[model samples]
Target: MTTLTTTRGDITTEHVDVVVNAANNAMRGGGGVDGAIHRAGGPDILRDCITRFPDGLATGDAGWTTAGRLPARWVVHTVGPNHGAGQRDRGLLESCYRRSLEVADELGARSVAFPLISAGVYAWPRRQAVTVAIDTIATTPTKVEEVRLVAYDAGVHQEIASSLTMATSVRILQGVRALHRRGYHGLRVNPGVAPSGLFWRVVLTDAADPGSSVRYTSADEAKFAGGVVDAMTTPHEVAEQILRALPRLRPANDAPAYAAWFAGLLAAVEPEHALPVSSADYFDDTDGWEIGWNSGLRYPAPPLDADSSQ
Candidate 1:
């Protein structure tokens, strides 16, 4: 089983099978986790990485080095991306975790440690960045038994704690749906109801925190609104409609459903602009959430009212 752990300590002093150095493309010393690992592991680690990975590893790619003075036998060097949205950086960051695990598995290491990649001086907001890091770890099918995310400060620690909360929220939602399947609820969306052509559910949040309250709406509404706005005979007509819908939202945080729906809608609407649709690509996102679709395995749509058939 894979487990998530948090700690704050020198990666070198921590007694583990491997310590992952949140590294840079050069594999040389810079700041943050990179500098720390290079400083503790000594200059030889850098020299070895350079010799071993001469092609200049891309951001999110990883390589390995001897632990040097660090307590572990090997140090996996992974380059995380700088913070950005839908930028190539996101892909690179995902690659960082994927490559690191690959390196660890190749070495047959059972345990590994990671710093909050790109969340420090790299300017990735601690909250958003940590989610991506944790999500990447959770979704990977690698054989490592334990993965520790070492948070260096209170801010980073809180971020990791929040990730835990989000994961819990997901579990709770699953439980709710499961209970409904067992006839535990008075009003539940029938799991048997087949999805109707890329429906979206957007949850708007006032507080950005994962645990905050949220308001939900169907994506069909947004699509209708867009069409209405485009068709309005006068500017006032569109503005009036927007104002009428404004009060529907109260101050609250968006639930995970919001993000999941948006990601899916984007892919469904513009497949070219979205990330690749696969277990590998879905795990690559910060959400660490997975959704799949198959033409032959679909449930019957609304009128048919039949359960899914594989």
Candidate 2:
């Protein structure tokens, strides 16, 4: 029952049994997901596929090969319909997902991760592509326990996340959907200056925000003190930077300002100086107003009780 959305991450690193590579018909690495997978998995993967796939797969076709240096044991290669050839057939793209799952079933892969097929360098419309992918996966059945749709950018990931949230809402209305837990929490962090490796983690529980308003906690006190000088010298500049730390929590149509602010924060906070923490960790029944943290956490507050916090 676990479904999640992520942006631009390697599937093999998730420790999933297999990863789907959005490969070209020839099974050769092109751009986007195909090239990334090939580069990460190493040449041995290509060597294994050389003799087995002499005839290049056709559009809407899929194949498999051993994972070379990737964490997964196998890679499911599928050729999806690229929009470039004036192709707008939704069925063709849907088949790519169906066939990819079929290949995973045959390979006995317990879990698999998917990139937004045909969306990247292929130039497929993001919204339509997401709808097709989510719909196709929702209809498909398999032994696979999990299917993760990995996005290449924040906008992409946010769109997919919103779409899934909407779909889940509809299912709930139809009495077909059930939530695992209320008050779900998610954290996205960058370890380096640029936050290249965005760490996203989530947990579902009923724990309240800790009650305390200490600006400097045990974990962050030293860092806060070290940053005090910057804050004192450039107080206005630091305030501006803090104001810019908010990310777009909702769809673009709804929160463009938040998105802009998030970008600003990403630029403002030198990743080396002040890394953001998830909201759930910031506030609580005990802690009143911890101002220095980020708010990626979604709690089931009074009016929205039982609401699924995506």
Candidate 3:
């Protein structure tokens, strides 16, 4: 599995196998990351670019050059779509990341560092740029073991972190659905957990009104059934909490069948949070029959009147 992370630092200084440059189509190096890379890597980079890409590259395409004086072995140059020039096709922007990873794969790079392409002089919206970078890199298949999304400033780093948190929250919700399909009852949503954004908490209750509560305020405070499981901030913690609570909620007989049912439910919902529904909204259906897990299975849902206990 690939690990994705973010940091605030100079992309040219990253000690990774490959560092990506947000270059213009000219590839001779312009402002922003392109200029910083060329200036730091010295003349050998330009010399190699001239010989390899004499006519320059098109937008959304990528090529590599010698790292020159930089710490990395190779500098993968990718031209981002100019959002200010009215070239707003998201596919072009996504192509930049996809093509760069393809180049990295060919070069046998195990770790790669990337800057927020097109968010600078190219005028791409910062939030959208970060989203595209994270989503594309996270989903794209590559042999690379680690991918770092580098931000030049603290503000940008925070923005990327927020995006990551949102992504993890979506994954946690998916995990909650997975546990529910396995016949693990007493699941509830903690809406008050997150004051803003899409960061909501999911709780596994032991009864209609939980006599006990495991408050997950900080990483150090995370506990499941009076024992440490995982940090509340991680998606793995969500899965672990549900698994640890399973035996107490249901019998151990045919556990594999329950696991298989959970897997099937997980696979049925593609693209993580594509269901267009939330745990809070699950009981709003007036028909009294709980919403079906998927199109094929329609198990009766638990009563919703007790949701206020959260």
Candidate 4:
């Protein structure tokens, strides 16, 4: 499957196999992403457009040319339907992505970067533009390993990637809701603050005691957040709203004296397999006492919450 992702950067500097440009049918050069690519890629691109596509290109169709000087090997140019000019067929908007990918595949491009076609000067609604671009790229069959939806600014980048975080937070919400139905009491969806970004911490607690909890963190690496948010803040408004409407959080460090009680809880929960060692916390006091043993998930790990779907 082609991994769809978002990056907040200049598409011209993208070091991918191909950089898809949202060009006018004239194909020579234009504004926005088109002009940027042409300028960065130098005059050979214009030369290729003049020599190869003498008649320009058809709306919604795509053609490729040499990258000239850009890091990419080729540039796939597609004409997006001008929504402002009354050409509003969404199929044509979707075609910009589909045809670009098709052209990329013909060039055997394993990776490609694309701007949100028509979202700029053409004035296609930004949200709808994102939807069409992702849906078309995802449904299109190709061998491309990675496709980046490149945004020119931090805000646009966050808006594009929020679609992904919405899915993740929803899945997490549903999961905790399931455990709540299963009678698990102490629960939470919290963050582990890091320098780059936050990691997810899903805590499930003992049904009877309601104090002990087993943590399931999303060990995945941090995504590019465009430097807009992290553990202290997040661009995921849906997740924040979901968490706020859920339940009261019980801080995990509240019962540190009982840490040993939940120490072996993970093993008991999954008796069939041994859980791997994870980075945790160690407490120490300088009373001239020798360290005997140490155990626990990372400190300030997050907090637990009561069961509530609302």
Off by over 4 Å in 4: 167-310
Q: What TM-score goes with each of the models?
A: 0.57, 0.54, 0.65, 0.56
RMSD (Å) of each candidate, 1 decimal: 17.2, 16.1, 8.3, 15.3
Alpha carbon lDDT at 39, candidate 2: 88
Q: Judging by TM-score against the true structure, name the best candidate.
A: 3
Candidate 2 Cα misplacement greater than 4 A, ranges: 1-8, 172-310
lDDT of 1 by residue, 46-162 (tens): 888878888767777787888888888889888777665333356667677878989899999888998878876567766556656766776677888888888768776776764
List, residue by residue over 1-310, the lDDT tens digit for candidate 3.
6778899998889999999999988778888899999999999999999999999999999999999999999999999999999999988999999999999999999999999989998899887788788768866878998889999899999988766655554455455555555544454434223333233444445444465433332222334345543211344456556556544555222234334433444453332222222233333433322222233323223334433322
Task: Residues 1-310, candidate 2: write the lDDT tens digits.
Answer: 3244555555546578878888888886777778888888999878877866888788887888988899888898888787977777778888888898899999988788898889976777777788778767766767777788887688888987766643432222111001111101211111111133232221211123232111323223113322421111233332222223222211113223322333444333321122333334324523221212343322222222212322
lDDT, residue 165, candidate 3: 59
After superposition, candidate 1 runs with Cα above 4 Å error = 84-88, 174-310
Between candidates 1 and 2, the TM-score winner: 1
